[model samples]
Target chain A: MTQISLAKCKVDQLVKLCEEFGNQEGELINVLHKAQELVGYLPREVQEVIARQLNIPVSKVYGVVTFYSFFTMTPKGEHPISVCMGTACYVRGAEKVLDEFKRVLKINVGETTPDGKFSLTSLRCVGACGLAPVVLIGEKVYGRVTPGEVEKILKEFN
Target chain B: MENNITLKIDNREISVPKGTTILEAARELGIDIPTLCYMNLKDLCIKNAPASCRICVVEVEGRKNLAPSCATRCENNMVVRTNTMRVLNARRVVLELMLSDHPSDCLVCAKSGNCELQDTAIKLGIREIPFAGEKSEFKVDLSPSIRRDASKCIYCRRCEMMCNDVQTVGALGAVNRGFSSVVMPAFDEALIDSECTFCGQCVAVCPVGALTELSHTNRLINDLANPSKTVIVQTAPAVRAALGEEFGLPAGTSVTGKMVAALRQLGFAKVFDTDFAADLTIMEEGTELLGRLNAFLNGDKEVKLPIITSCCPGWVNFFEKQFPDLLDRPSSARSPQQMFGAIAKTYWAEKMGIKREDLIVVSVMPCLAKKFESERDEFKTNGDPDVNYSISTRELAALIKETNINFMQLPDEDFDAPLGESTGAAVIFGASGGVMEAALRTAYEIQTGKTLENVDFEGVRGIENLKEATIDVDGFELKVAVAHSLGTARKLMNELRAGTCKYHAIEVMACPGGCIGGGGQPFHHGDSARIKARAKALYTEDAEKSFRKSHENPYIVSLYEEFLGKPMSERAHHLLHTCYFNRGKEIIEQ
Candidate 1:
């Protein structure tokens, strides 16, 4: 089932965006990037619309979306939290920092808070290996984050 | 002068044309190299050499690592060892890793004996799996015609290539990432919910037990055991051509008489032929084509040209899902399987003084889609299906084996009278361009007031993807086309969609070589030669028939006179014709 009723205006905007890309199948990933930006996140309805506009199978659209971890089918929270799991961060105890965030947020990785205020995700190499075990909330970054500093980091977002 | 590449394989020198893979070069030298995730149906222009499965790894003299023989091109003077210790160890390790992630249920697996993975395991002399880990598990998707067991999938991607690239159905794709990756429908939906045409090409190409036909042999056995019900069976023309392969008989060997005898021994009350209904199909479809052509000639702008054949259920589902707008362009005549079911359940049932519910009609087809076709709601009345069950040629062969009947030793026996009788045109329905040729043989004679001495329409009789020809029907130039496989069909459909198609009639078969290369036929393992052989067998049978045209079948003529007034009559339309649905709308609405 469609996870959300994508607004009619948003649907029109998606179609317009696809038309701008010439609706070529080769531009699928590019179209999907713009679609995700417009729709906040790629839901079933959004993917279906993009597939119809591009004249390809919805399964193919879903395949491309699922292949990359950067693309998400579910909506991200307003204050998104990303835990860097690069080699430097993992060696510096990023798993403990991630576990602390999961405990305090009461949500697993790639999940949003019940109030939809914060979403937790683990990404690879944000190019800040010097600040190992880094945790970023929205635009603010906390370098060399420890397990105890997770709640304080959440308080700043609040 | 052709540029050739010289290669040394197992100390044997051989020269092959440029761009030939090491696998092909080795094969040329009669060196059998094991491979998986590599398929080449050259005749259909379909090849899936992803090199995902490293089972075909070989030792190259200069390379640091073992190269996949299936993907590596033969280099001039390049030394290759197919059976070195290093190569054997790497191959075994690769297979062990695959087995660690795959379920060990081969004993009860549908493709137990026929699985390529299992064969490779034995060929490599693998006794124990040295590696064990968590096996990926996914819910089995059981569609009407095929079964999908994702747990058994080894990520070969052969099914993906067949579904998307070859058939252009787009029902399956490689989804997710890493260990959880699988070839499945979008959103992990069941195949029935997706745009799957039930072509079963995915099942045909799968090297493991991940994909297989949803068999009806068990239910058929139950029906045969039920004494209260009189079970009658009809075998499709293509089944006779390829069924012998299941019993170790060579490809292209027609075992029609032996097959009939086996079915009789299997305790069926009557063993009929689907070719009878194929003849009936030509009578209705040929007449419909003539009517539309004549109407178009008389300045009727509404008449749709290029009337596509509706015999292949896989092709029917393809148009319904992909080309819904051109629904009116296809002929309305039901497939031969459905036509036979309708006749058997109505005319024959009543004549035998048997109630419809008491009479069971089973079809032995060389197709997987016919199983899905038989289950369609349109082919049913008051919850009772016209055909009680549909089984494949492989299933019949299995039944003959399960019953301990020596298929090779069986005596030659003819089909039962009346319903069993058919014409040459009907038998040719097994091949790709056959329906178009059969219809032309009858339509040419019926349109002009001249006898068709030359029944063979050579232009439409081949394995070409898209074939076109023009015939002189009196003074009129009648244009026609034939296409096999959905990818080829899509090209023609796109032409019609663009309003550029000029043919008056077109025929499309979903499989590569029509029913002879059907997904439910004996597994060719991506060999185009086997498919060619099966097609040759069908043509041989067609040549041997006494009556070459559908109209020449006396039983069909008598049936029209006694039961159904004539072709396209009200009664005939109700039973012999059907309508199309916009499955695209259904999917979108859902």
Candidate 2:
């Protein structure tokens, strides 16, 4: 993953987000959430800014960011793709569907395409068990996702 | 009486404090409980009782499961069984499961004989790990002062606590989760690249082979074997108090004479004392303090007050990284280890007719940061370090044993002349408040020009993390503060940064109880009494000396007269004084 420099980020906005939470260490998760929303991901430079504002160590901020699955250190593409790897989805061949997405997009899990169009990731239990194999792109959930439909899913993003 | 609670352990009745943990109460009763992830240094206010390691679990009456004695608080009528059959089985299973994933390369490990895990395994009589599983492996991380082997880590988090909570360094933390979890620096940055100050407190607390000092004994051995080099060794003040522990002697036994004899046996050309350089440090540092004080009194607004001692390399790295804006506030005097190296390679080498390149200066210090300090670019000449390398007291002890020299059987011998003689003021530099007191002894007499009948400044002594004292020198009140451990140093530095500091001088040491509790000293195993004992030994040595002030050392006076004109002179400044850098700029402002 390429390192996103702080020069490219809206540094002022990051400080404003920390000030929004009164710069308290207790509000770290909330600050990280807002930071990810502002910069699309929590990079090293962004976490450093938040840590400085919160009067804590950057290592601690990074530790918290890595602990929870919601926070991402690398930037997601314009359209982020997540394949559900829940037990129900796995029983219905979600692995094959994920593999199809990997082959079609030329990118592996936790990575983005070079064209900045799509990124792929996997999650456990998206709570759409009735749909068995499930896949989510942004806010749109495609139930009963098949390995063959992986191409169709990419076509819509394109 | 109301605060006291009665409790029973293995049918023995005992009364304890209301909030006392089962571990402490059981210890009072002479119950030996095996623990892995529990550490408590009460004197320094450092405690790491994560209870993640279930080896300390014990049976409790009317409880559903075994309770972790290290964290479980005692209550009235509570009955605990520390060595019950069920508890033993549970502990054995926990140990087996932990050993299942842990690497079993104990023989070649750096911490093999001294490892607490090995001792516990022996005590438990564990023949083999019944559980078999895939072990987690990781590449070893090496730094100038410390080595981290995550594969040997038991997810104890003792290092994590010492780094983040106690030292406030925040270099190591618990990352990832479960079987894949390991304590590491942020973003997996190397320790040298991270916020680590190379204090080595983490290594001091580690129970296994996970964290250990980066050994330089092998290099020292090779250097000694080379007949072309005139190898000289300098022993720091703290080494005398603690080196005895490596042998059969008690923690606080002063083995200065025997240590010099052992160094001679190790084939070192000259066995000098860093205490001599410590006396010279006072000459340089004391003059700098007086100059700063005089300037500050004359209303020279640019001069920084409360000149902090720069002898501790760990504390120097700390301020440079954490409080970079106040970098100029610290004294520019080089540490005794570096001063000895610089002077040995120059004045001493020239006097002995040995070339600088051929004269190798090695220091035995009670600090890991000394190793890092010896390698700093500014301390080097044309790419050759002033001090070739530094070995810890533990490393020196290992080298003695490795050389087949029986330390206990060695005769007590005096150090070599010229660079071996030192005053009592220099010997106390091992303890936390020793520097401040030593400076006061000289600074008071110099500032007042009166005969000081009472040389002892008893106020700035002891094992407290922070201590403050005010001395009236010629009716001019001189305020001073002494702080040990980076945690307390942070508190003092934060005060200085905020402009609320009222001290004229402050001495800060990175390790608890100063160099006596240094990271490279023999492990105290969370025993605060051992630290106090070391400090007492230093004070006792000081009381018995003829010259109690740094300015009174005859050799120091002659060296200044023959070579350097005076303290703070151009020659003295060039050889003894050094500067600080702003290491926080890249991370904080980039």
Candidate 3:
């Protein structure tokens, strides 16, 4: 069983955020998005609070959260790295670059480093196939990446 | 704004929409312009224009190099010779180049007869490859529900476009460049390790055997050879409607009994029906819907509006990834596949006096998503998966052929008594709006305290993506909504959020036509055949049935009386119902 604890200060902050976005109705998704941003993930305590504040069921909130790809409930690392492996990128060896990142990071895609410095993730084609082999470090896009460029990319992130 | 273009294709002058591609105009004029990468209007046109394959070249008047029709837009007055000598030679050259690197071993490949490449070669009358090059050597990926053979890929980008743009789960893309270009997941990660739901949409669109469903019948054969495991097979409601296509039986032919007999001939210990669990799902879900409605009436704090059906694993996964906050609203009742596993492990194990672990539950479904659903952590029953294995309808047909079973001569046999027995309400579980209709059949009866003379809720049954109905039951009018595809589901959800539509209940299935038209079902040119077949079989099964409603299912009544106490009872809620958590910002770490 996963033990859940409610942090009063954080809960109050989340409640204030929810109130800022119009208490109920369509505010469920808005509140959830802000909660995820604040807590890194939509933890159970935050969901329960949102459910109570919105006067909606926890199941409904969970269903919406689970149905969308954008939502995540777990804590993330300080720096997140997402590599695009779309058709154009794939044709140009984006996969090999990703493999080098996995090897260098000593962590698989979707896994964060033990020190919490970086999290590596792979995305389907980001519609940037023309560039071939593109990697996104946060909002910045690096096109035509080689396997050898992975170490330099990681150093920049750190 | 009114720029109509008249094009002469094969000597017929036809008017087409302004800016229509030459291929589209040609299609309207009933002229065939063969293309590998051009799939209708969906994919990117001809891999960066001027045609990479050059197969669709047509002799447009005054155009040099025989303009590729797919890339060139229609002009005001175009004289196109679709079947000229120059066009034929150009198509032949293109076919020859495509076949150069392709494996000549088409006879053994899964897509041998169905491959578009082979069909194009045959059409172009090319028996030999003129330009040979170093063929890419790649091993087969026998991952979860799909197989990948990169060596056979033509770099058509059909699968890539569909996966990234259509489904939006970009699991596969081109890796490396130039001669070494290969389509694969990032870092060569196993597909099972990614977010792929194994919907098989990519497989359906693939022009060659580069993508296929992973086959597990060999392991089944090995298990059959071993004297230890007691293997029992169950066919989903959708499989019976589509499996007949493999045989010369017309699509939608009710081959339920023949399907069972075929499995029995293949030496299975027992042949069961997933429709039985589909009935069981109705019993559980129908009662849950009533309970939720009652809770709302009573002003319960937990107001989970529009309880979504969680039967389609693909839809469930889609929701889990995209709408994690709404997970709690999904019906806690496991899908017919998962329910079959739970019942087979618990009740069937007790009835057979065999250890639950010893019974191998093999499911034949019309879906590739079931392959992934079977591996979900939530599906585990007492430490082991309730269902041991799941095989798609196509793979099962392949297995029957591999085992040298005489499917034509097999006599129809009945499914095993207790667990095999299902109601008409269950049979419709294969088609769209089936779950809602099944639930309504039982819920109306339960709520009204009177038998529903007409079990068929005609208003809710159809192939449309979204449907709505207002039923007057015992002076209470219930508004219901049904949506099958994600696009439609999104529409309904948006409407609900905007307060534009208010309904007591809403049913949404991820696929277009429910399980019958699932991503894992047989690849049909169009859904008309399979949809008609499934709909006809479901209604026919309903008309011929003694019990047409879930409430009338004696097994369900007895199960509730013996153990569950009642529908939505405390124990039943604990065992049959489960809570969902919001995975808001957590990436599903594979």
Chain A alone, TM-score for each of the models? 0.87, 0.79, 0.71
Which ranges of candidate 2 are over 4 A from the true structure? A1-5, A99-109, A113-117, A124-130, A138-143, A146-158, B1-3, B587-590
Give per-residue CA lDDT, model 2, range A1-158, as digits (tens): 11225663366788888898999999999999988988889888888878888999888998898888789887898999989998999999999999999998899998889988899999999998999799999999999988988888789866
Model 1 Cα displacement at A37 (Å)? 1.6
Q: Against the hidden reference, what TM-scores do the models get?
A: 0.96, 0.96, 0.73
> What DockQ results for candidate 1?
0.42
Please identify which of the two predictions, 2 or 3, would achieve the higher lDDT against the true structure.
Answer: 2
Docking class of 2: acceptable
Enumerate the candidates' DockQ scores in order.
0.42, 0.39, 0.04
lDDT of 2 by residue, B1-590 (tens): 56589989999999997889999999999999999889888877788898999899999999999999999999899999999999999989988899899899898999898888888888888999999889999889998889989899898899888888878999898887778888888888888888899988998889899999999999999999999999999999999999999897887899988999999999999999999999999988998899999998899998889899999999999988889898888999999999999999999998999999998999999999999999999999999999999999999999999899999999999999899999999999999999988888888888888878898888899888889999998877899999988988899888887889899999999988899999999988878788889998999999999999999999999999889889999998898999888888353333
Mark the regions of model 3 whose C-alpha exceeds 4 Å error after superposition: A1-158, B1-7, B12-33, B40-54, B65-78, B101-108, B134-142, B164-166, B170-189, B493-501, B526-533, B569-590
Between 1 and 3, whose DockQ is larger? Answer: 1
Off by over 4 Å in 1: A1-6, A86-88, A103-107, A113-115, A124-132, A139-158, B1-3, B585-590
User: TM-score for the first chain of model 3?
Assistant: 0.71
Q: lDDT winner among the candidates?
A: 1
Instruction: Note the residue pairs that clash in candidate 1.
Output: none
True-structure RMSD, every candidate: 2.3, 2.4, 10.6
Model 1 lDDT per residue over B511-555, tens place: 988888898998998888889898899888899999999999999
- Score candidate 2 by DockQ: 0.39
lDDT of 3 by residue, B92-143 (tens): 8778866887899998898888788888888877867879788888877776
